[model samples]
Target: MVDTKLKFGVHIRRAADKAAKMTTALSRLMANTRGPRASRRRVLMSVVHSILLYGVEVWADSLSIAYHRKRLAAVQRRCALRVACAYRTVSHEAVMVVAGAIPIHLLAKERKEVYQKKGQPGTRATKKEESREETLGRWQEEWDAAQKGQWTKRLIPRLGPWLGRSQGEVDFFLTQLLTGHGAFRAYLHKMGRARSPMCLHCGDAQDDACHTFFVCERWAGWRRAVEDELGRLQPETLVLKMIESDRNWKRVATFARAVLSEKRMELASQGPASHEGTSSSEED
Candidate 1:
């Protein structure tokens, strides 16, 4: 063991001597350079000096001392992060290889793409902006002004008893009206993608709200029942009359909701079957 230690010490001493000679040579080269070349030479000399320093420390079997010196220098340079030491059972190089495998930039890019796709708008329409009280007031004011102007006249019963509803319930009913329009608009928006305004269910060329509600064969029978019940009112006016009628509005609303829900369920169930039949026909 003593002989082995002596042999290792001699090799380390020789390696340290070689590193010292290399540093001396770099210093001489920097001294020999002049003018513009001197800056480049100085940078090269510094790098060579650092390499020699690391080499000498390694050869002296004092890599820990060199690492601590480097960390202290980083602190002085304002680039050091707080670090705690642990007795790592694994090799340093192995730890470094594992750390390098982490795709941090890729993860960051993915997060950015997701944010771009679904990030909320900076400014959005708020509940206060479109609140029920505000909307009802605006509509009532317009209706009153119109009645005075003879421009548009709302049915009298609609304005009288309906105005007695609390702000929340009125807002809910207004929301339901807007939801119906939105559903219609959403269908048009999708059909527009194919450059056609055809109803998806009936394939009718004119797939506006009235057509879907009143003309589409898929819902014509249901529409007749609702219209007949509402006294053969125009399709556009049926909803208003139903809502305004003396009958229990809550029960009527529930019935309307049930019909809409069942129709949606029927469509959803039939969709897959239709799609499967189309695909099978194509294969044949």
Candidate 2:
């Protein structure tokens, strides 16, 4: 009989090697270019991941195997390191989390979820010739409408040099703020997963994008480090006007990385039940 196991072993390595080359080439291309992190991140996802997952649906379960899993994980780490311009010593999970790149398995899982679903709710019907940007804009308009209920205006910063940091960081920050799919109690409650929408850290008020950064007492220690990078403590609201350039946004994104990371860790400590909402990427 043909050794299916052996063949898959070979197949995964070949896939990883190809992905590595693309990762390297893309890394080099990204290094010299300038643009918004989200834009670059989109390119990275469009290119590298598209290559890495070309036939993943058929073989994704092999990821449970230690050998194949390690090989692909290495590829992910190397690619992430290149994208973030981070050191080799950093853990891949941390690099990815900081960059806003989801775990490879999580990415695969998200893809499956998308395939199983139809479309986002409240979506405007589009022409068959609709571009991806058009769909995205419609979704954004719907999301912005829902957001108006909470804030008098959109408080999530949308200024640019989009930031000097990698697209992953910018992606992570924007996704957390605009998308309800994140590690926040408000999001969890909205999904009917959490017992309450209050801050797990303080348990006093609704935990939100702004409150997590400005109000949580559990994060005071981490907040100072973020503030030191910024010149002053950011006020409760971070309107786009405060961000002057991409350089300043990069600094803000960095601070965002630090604080949000702590909150992610805190949520992790609360156990698996806390992440029920975050486990799946569902439409709002």
- Which regions of candidate 1 deviate over 4 angstroms? 1-161, 165-178, 181-197, 206-208, 246-255, 266-284
Candidate 2 lDDT by residue in tens digits, 165-231: 2333444543354332456777677666666788876776688766776667777776677566555
lDDT for every model? Answer: 0.34, 0.53
Q: Candidate 2: where are CA atoms >4 Å away?
A: 1-37, 41-153, 156-169, 178-180, 228-242, 276-284
The best candidate by lDDT is 2
* TM match of model 1 to true structure: 0.31
Question: How does model 2 fare in lDDT?
Answer: 0.53
| 1-284 per-residue lDDT for model 1 (tens digits) | 66755664565445345544554544443321122232243343344334333333222333323333332232211100001010122122111111111111222222333334343544323432333344445444534544231211222213434344331121111222212321232232342322344556777765544554546677666656655566653544543564565453443344344444544454355444211111010100
- Model 2, residue 29: what's the lDDT? 60
